[model samples]
Target: MPHYYLHLYNDMIVADEEGLDFPDLAAARAGAIENIRGLICETVSKGCINFSHRIDIADASGEVLTSVSFGEAVRVDG
Candidate 1:
């Protein structure tokens, strides 16, 4: 299993010091999306959502594998 770091990029850069083990990149990406959704839920009470928020998935060597935008994770209809 390889370790993947999901770093949050919102108003500030929240680094994931303690990385997680995932079988592959796809799983890591999914994990990032899930985390973003949870974060969004928590932020709902704040009365403002920043769609530009994103999570950058980085490898052990500090290379960013992919990024998941908060806007991409949820569908907003008004």
Candidate 2:
């Protein structure tokens, strides 16, 4: 199974969904990124910390797939 790494401030989140089949890789990747951003925003909000940090998510190969700045993420309007 393929694995993904979501890097956060003090912890790293990993998910193994390689064996799962998807219709589109782009959609799957984008969905994964969005999910991580939501998680980051939720964590920051609950901790009352500055949701102004950037999060970097990478693949198993250590390649950065996407970067989400805190400001852009915390915004209410999409």
Candidate 3:
């Protein structure tokens, strides 16, 4: 199983730059949510931001993985 890392920003995830890998899209989404949960919590705790935002999913090649819509889709233009 390839490890997926959800690179998060203050606003939204860098869809085009993020790289995630999993046996399926559902798993990837689950992982991404888990990863971002901490960051989201911290941001809220500091009163920096609210609303759980996320990006779809992008491959290592910077291609938008349409199967996932949990956030902004990266590499969509490409």
Candidate 4:
């Protein structure tokens, strides 16, 4: 198992000081998506969503492995 940090990048940088442990990068990616969805749900009550916001998944050494944009996680209709 390895620790992966999912840092949020919205209006500002929110560092994940306590990282989560996952079996692999794939699992970490899934966790990131899950987290983003939960965050979006919480923000819905705020009446605004920053689609450009993103989560940067990093390894224990702080090297970003990949990123997932809020816009990419959900479907929006006109």
What candidate 3 gets wrong by more than 4 Å, as runs, is 1-9, 12-20, 66-78
What are the per-residue Cα lDDT tens digits for candidate 4 across 1-78? 899999999889999999999999999988988998999999999998999999999999999999999998899889
Where model 2 places Cα greater than 4 Å from the true spot, the runs are 10-47, 76-78
Best by lDDT: 1
Model 3 TM-score is 0.53
Alpha-carbon deviation at 23 in model 1, angstroms? 0.9
Give the worst 10-residue stretch by lDDT in candidate 1: 42-51
Better of 2 and 3 by lDDT: 2
Clashes of 3: 6
| TM, every model | 0.95, 0.43, 0.53, 0.91
* Candidate 3: clashing pairs of residues: 15-74, 16-74, 54-71, 55-71, 55-72, 56-71
Q: After superposition, how far is residue 43 of candidate 4 from its true place, in Å?
A: 1.2
In order, the Cα lDDT scores of the candidates are: 0.96, 0.53, 0.52, 0.94
Q: Give the C-alpha lDDT of model 2.
A: 0.53
Q: lDDT by residue for model 3 over 2-56, one digit each (tens)? A: 5444544446445334365598666877766665565555665777644435544
